[model samples]
Target chain A: MTDWTIDSLVTALRTRRISAVEITDDCLARIDRLNPAMRTFITVDADGARRAAKERDSDLAAGRALGPLHGVPMAWKDLCAAPGLPTSCGTRTRDYFVSEMPCTAVARLVAEGAITLGKTNMTELALGPFGDNAHHGHVQNPWRSGHCSGGSSSGSGSAIAAGLALGALGSDTGGSIRLPAACCGIVGLKPTYGRVSRAGAMALSWSNDHLGPMTRTVRDAALMLGIMAGWDAADATTSRRPVPDYLQGIDRGIRGLRVGVPSNYYFDEVDAEVVTAVREAARQLGTLGARVSEVRVPDPVPLGEATGVISRAESVTIHERLLRERPQELQPVVRTRLEFGEHIAAHQYLQALRGRGRLTQEFLRAVFSQVDLLIAPTIPEPAPEIANVTTGGIDEIIKKMGRFSRLTRPFNGLGLPALSLPCGFSTRGLPLALSIVGRPFDEATVLRAGHAYEQAAGWVNRRPAIG
Target chain B: MNPSSTDPGVTAELTRLSDIIERLSRGLGLADEPASFVTVLEEGAPGDD
Candidate 1:
């Protein structure tokens, strides 16, 4: 029962096989049983969830119009405002901070009749890639104890993996969504910049920040993304383009779709097992009728460096007040991380932005014209022991942090839609992933390719040994 | 900018950005372009590209 995906739960609820209250109670019970070990949730409003479930059941009985996610139990990363719950962001600074209003993304989900379980934990201020929270407890990877559930959307990833929640909303500045999705063996989608509104979410890097869905299956991601992606008056950056029915074409097989295999950069320094898994994922796509071709992508070095410039500068600007007013309240890693961005000059930050345009142009000309989708590894290595990486001094930890997001951040700079789903598992049992990237505003293509690969690889059905 | 004003972590990051800035400046010719980060929209105007 706990292992059921969001789609299955929704089907059961609609058919009266299970009531919404029963599903909500089961999720609450699982969170109660496993959350102590997993630490995936910052708050669990079991009573509120039960109440909402009852309302949903009554609405169904009354023949009320149902949303696609009707009565689905899910959680939001603590960075998003959840009205009653405190958006702590895994920092001591906001330990008791409660949002007066709900964020646009969560509001849309609630409109669709999804019941909130509670807010999950995250890296402080969404700063670090590894989900080590000095203020809150660690979000443990359900695959193995003592291993990291890649972060800033740490708890969202862990909860989905551990079956504590059906799906979760996570924001990505760099690789916050994909890294965790990859590490925890779930499906994570980082839509093109401006595809999803960020009205009520904490701002990390305004230019780079994106809200996305992390779920157990690609179809669930599609359903959640369809609900969340659209124009919002609150967020000026959201696209005006009409939201496509992502699930309508989701089952469209990738026959004759051009798949690009990068000739350089994405695989550099990647672990052998990860490379094999990604390559095998591409091969599986080939089996599904995708035309695979090797192509040279724009050098990611400048793109990555440019991301650092823009993200750091923007973070410093956003947190300047907090840093000055109460720096000590933040996790040391997060504090130092934000502080490092203070020196980035206006000219350098601008240079990155200008380069972003040039690089996006070059990427479109060089890659997208040749292929419908590009397949790459989401991360270089499997989840490392939290004890080892988080302890090797700040400098060492920072260096390792760079590696965790090396592959994913470049796409954020390009504003391309990218998806990370479990492709295989390492010998030590951690999940490895394949990233499928598509042109701007073309997430449907990326999701379609991912769905085909997911069906072929058959990794969506593998549950972690825990809970 | 003297590197000694900040701690090693800050200095290290500054050094990295400096290298990247130098490369981006040289590799991508944007001398004529203004460096803009966020895409600003006029009131009541949609901001999709």
Candidate 2:
């Protein structure tokens, strides 16, 4: 039962080997036993989940079929608005906030026959990279309790790692999804900007934000992404392009693929252990008939600065009215950051936008010209202590957040797709991951390479012991 | 006038910008102390002069 991946679970259900209700019950039992220490969920709708499972069972019995994720129990980050669940965004201002209608992504998943377990925890206002929520308390890492679980999708990562949920939806602005996935030893995908809709999810940054899936394996992440991607009327930024069958290319081997490694900025000042692990992953790819070479990234610091400008400017705008009226409602860290956005000059914001297009074109011309994907350490180091995050001091908090997300923010600026997969574990028993980034709208290449590496490395088979 | 130019008009513009930020902080219930604030500018902002 503990060895069940989404593939194995779907096979079991299709063969009539086990009922959906039974699987739901097993998951609920695991949550009951493990959640006290993990604190992954702000709310768990077991009753609702059981009811959905029973209905799926009936459909199976009647031969009225649903989609691929039929009868699967999954969780979503609290930021996603569901009909009856609170979309708190990990802040006290909207702690009791619930929506009459579900977010477009959540509605689509339910329509595909996936059962919703409940909303998981997140960092306050989704601002900090460490998943410590002052309102709902901190979420512990499933692999090691005393350490941090990367945020603001902290609960999404921990829940899947502890088997509390089979899969989860997480929103990433600056490595929120990938960082947690790396820290929790799961597979997280940040699809190309505008590949997934951001209409109903809480907005942190209009330009850089992305919504995607986190799962225990690359194949499962691909399955969830296929269902989630598409154009939506509510979000104009969503591309009108057709959704590709992401799972279709999983078996495609990387025969002549070129993988580039950023030799300068990404490799500098990284933890020795994380650097060693990523180097080993590159070596393995080389042995598997793929060309691996070091590539230069000119001044990634400017890209990082541009990402900050856009994100902070948009965030301040989103909360402008709220900041004016209910100023005391936010956590100190979130409040200070939102206030800092006022300091961003209008011309500076516009200049950042100008630099963005030029930098993206430069990145594509230099790196993608020689390689199919770019590889780097997802995070420079393992999880830091939750207490290290300062409360009201915005500068201190931003520095801490930068440490966790610096490597991934530049890709967001370029509107490219990147996936994080566990490659090895740290000396302290935490996970270290490698990120595979692809060109715009080329999620297929990223997913294919991730799946192939996952098959060769066999890291997906290792599950954290929560009991 | 070049918006990027750092002239006396730009200094006046910075004063206005400071006023807006101060008002925003007051609205967000943040402390008005200078230590809590750090201005972020682009590489070639006129105000940096």
Second chain TM-score, each model: 0.51, 0.43
Top-DockQ candidate index = 1
DockQ of 2: 0.03
- Which 10 successive residues of model 2 chain B have the least lDDT summed? B35-44
Regions of model 2 farther than 4 Å from truth: A94-101, A390-394, B1-49
What is the per-residue lDDT of model 2 for residues A153-196, given as tens digits with 9 covering 90 to 100?
99999989888888899999988999999989999999988788
lDDT of 1 by residue, B1-49 (tens): 1365457657766786788788777766635354332232111112232
Worst 10-residue stretch by lDDT in candidate 2 chain A? A93-102
Clashing pairs in 1: none
lDDT of 1 by residue, A1-467 (tens): 55788888888899999999988998999899998878899888888899999999999999999999899999999988986677787777654344455799999999999999999989888998888887778889999889999998999999999888898999999999999999999999999888899998888899899999999999999999999999999988887778889999899899999999998998898999999998888888998999998889988888788888888889989888889999888777788888777777777887877777677667776786688889999989998889977896877888889888999998888878899999999999999999998877788888988888888888998998765
